[model samples]
Target: MHELIAAPFLEDFLLLRPGHASGVKIRGHHYLELRSLAAEEGPLPGWLCRAAHRRWGLDLDAHGSTREVVLVREPSPYGHGRASYEVNNGCNWACPHCVYGDKRHEGLPWPQRAKLLHTLRDAGVVWLELGGGECTIDPHFADTYAYAHDLGMMVEILTNGSTLDRPQLLGLFTGRRPYRITLSVYGATETTFDGFTQRRGAYRKFRRGLAAAREAGLPLSLSVVVTEANAHEAPAMRALAERYADRVREYTHMSPTFTGGSDPLAQQAPDYLHHRTPFTGCDAGHTSLNVNPFGLATVCKISRDHPIPLLREGVAGLTRLGGIADQALRRHSGCTDCALQQSCTTCMPLVTLYRKAGAPLDRYCQHA
Candidate 1:
């Protein structure tokens, strides 16, 4: 007998791909890809049949006697709940442990970036973070922020606060301002700050920028990153950070270089360098994604070397990227019975490092 096929019944929201992967949520229950849903043979659920008929005019009726699967690809609303885009890859300060490392400065043009932002907003991306070598340093920073703001998206900017005091840059936030500005505080003192950044008088510039942000009435927070060089001063730094903003965040762990292993200039700290609780797995590509200056989306900033161009493939591409990230999360055989499993930063990327270079797991582990 000939096979009977019924159109796929996708939920009202977008489905990135099979496996019920990440996508936007509109109303009601979550959406599932037809191909994946059909993989399981059984009586069709009433909800799936109803949604197929009502939303997409798809009648998911397999011949009364036999069942056949159906698939559909039509223009659908995408759900980009949250996203972070690196506006440019040109940092003013070169921190020794910086992983960004020599990435080309091929930022998307202003016009193209504006379109990308609009597309994201249209696709239901609610929370957007604009960051970069330094987002404010980008020539089109204001234009991009204004466009994102006008689209009804909550926008946030991450910067080192080097140019926050610039009159021209300050003007952009004078009117509506972003949801918040996250300033990375390198050190509590000028000498340490300048030493870490390798920029003469950067500390002074950062202070001026902080004052400017306050003057503009922008909501602000401080991010104090812990490194071996600055670990001793974290307590003092946290105290200073609180004075600047009520909300302060501290990062105690540094991952391997994107190229893998230690960077000559941006050296990776010892495995037991600064103290941090062990991480079981990474949520990159699943809960969040990082978009580089060139619009390549990847697992996270640390995993930028492996990236997928998000604009070209949309949510479907995200599905593939998520799978790659998930594979990276699979536990190594050695980790199954290890005593330090909970204390190791033993995620997929780290496992790739261990397998590729044969580096001691403890070398990349956050805990001793």
Candidate 2:
């Protein structure tokens, strides 16, 4: 119920509002000002009251006291400040393009999930993304989401939009307000969408959810996934998404499953397979990391080689993550001898998956 959250974000400090994307970054005297104000027992200073109103459309004075503001004075010892957590690898629809091959409906119960969220907060994660085979379908979706929001982390959800229409879910989101909810659009029409998902009435459900989300005025983003099944409707999908969301993105390339299975690659639309830009570098483990449902931490979602056991080792386990990221990004066996290494756009982990799957060279390699 705190209106304003003051916390350390890496080297900087942030004054964030729950359910809102816009925030005020403060340091030096400004940070000191808010810190002092948060410690006071009276009504908030007029400047802060006015600033909150002007910035986030929040009227701090209406709250009547400084108790509405929460400040985290302790700086996190961990370097990473962002993470993507898979709430569960479970989904309602069975899309062939899903990167997670097996849709197992399993995740930590509320108690364990609460501990993991606390760990993430203590580990300096300010921006948290909750995703999965379909995170909204997770039994603990509402609980996990509300807890993360209360922890003062800006939360983003990656969902398939099937469950968004539920009255309970709409009420939850309306109350807490996610930073953003990104939904994937498989197709524009019911036949293509349901066929692509291999589930009957999927498109109808998706539209219902989309309408509910829109009506709620919750922040929305859309991902138009172009696959062999839906490529013909790509333009329509984009147009439909644009109408519903403020931000719309189109994704054509399909990657292998996290377990190095190429099952998803079969859904790739050939005409949409454009060459990627040259591989430069990434800051996965250094700045961000990925965590599975069971609390296994990896450098990133793509490089899930040797996962660090977060539950066992705690935050200390993340110390070895940067090294793992370095190793995973390095040029591996196939790319080591390639003459076009500099021009090769695919990263090493992806190249490894491509090789493992016996996929067409043209899909990832310059040699083709």
Best by TM-score: 2
Evaluated at residue 247, the lDDT of candidate 1 is 76
| Residue-wise C-alpha lDDT for candidate 2, range 246-330, written one tens digit per residue | 8998899988887778899998989997767898888899879999999999989988988998887888888899999999998
Runs in model 2 deviating more than 4 A are 39-43, 70-73, 337-339
TM-score of 2: 0.95
Worst 10 residues of 1 by lDDT: 1-10
Error of 1 at 32 (Å): 22
Clashing pairs in 2: none
Candidate whose lDDT is highest: 2
lDDT of 1 at 4: 17
